[model samples]
Target: MHHQEIMSESIETTLALVDAEIVCFKFVVCGTVFH
Candidate 1:
């Protein structure tokens, strides 16, 4: 049970990181296009 919990937490952290990166990428793309 503890291992499963740890796995889930790690997954959530990774997903959050990915989401942040995607948002940052989109923002940069939009900025370049608009400018």
Candidate 2:
């Protein structure tokens, strides 16, 4: 049970990082296109 909790937390963290990166990338692309 403890191992499962750790695994889930790791997955969530990884997903969050990926999501942040994607949002940053989109913002950069939009900024470039607009300018």
Candidate 3:
């Protein structure tokens, strides 16, 4: 049970990082296009 909890936490963290990266990428793309 403890191992599973750790695994779940890591997965959530990874997803958050990925989401942040995607948002950053989109922002950069939009900025470049608009400028």
Candidate 4:
């Protein structure tokens, strides 16, 4: 249904944002440790 599609899209967006945030945080930590 249309509602299911919308829900999946929203979930996918949220997960992508979360993954990006985690990667950024990890890079920051590594930079600080190495620098």
Worst lDDT 10-window in candidate 2 = 1-10
Regions of candidate 2 where Cα sits further than 4 Å from its true position: none
Per-residue alpha-carbon lDDT of model 4 for 1-35, expressed as tens digits? 99999999999999999999999999999999999
Which ten residues in a row are the worst by lDDT in model 4? 1-10
CA deviation > 4 Å runs, candidate 1:
none
For residues 3-35, could you state the per-residue lDDT of candidate 3 as single tens digits?
999999999999999999999999999999999
The alpha-carbon deviation from the true structure for residue 3 of candidate 2, after best TM-score superposition, in angstroms, is 0.9
User: What are the clashing pairs of model 1?
Assistant: none
State how far residue 28 of model 3 sits from its true place (Å).
Answer: 0.4
TM agreement with the true structure for every prediction = 0.94, 0.89, 0.95, 0.88
Task: TM-score winner between 1 and 2, please give it.
Answer: 1
* Total backbone collisions for each predicted model: 0, 0, 0, 0
Ranking by TM-score: 3, 1, 2, 4
lDDT for residue 30 in candidate 3, whole number 0-100:
100
Q: After superposition, how far is residue 30 of candidate 3 from its true place, in Å?
A: 0.4
Instruction: Quote the RMSD, in angstroms, for model 2.
Output: 0.6
Mark the 10 consecutive residues where model 1 has the least summed lDDT.
1-10
Please say which candidate is ahead in TM-score: 3 or 4.
3
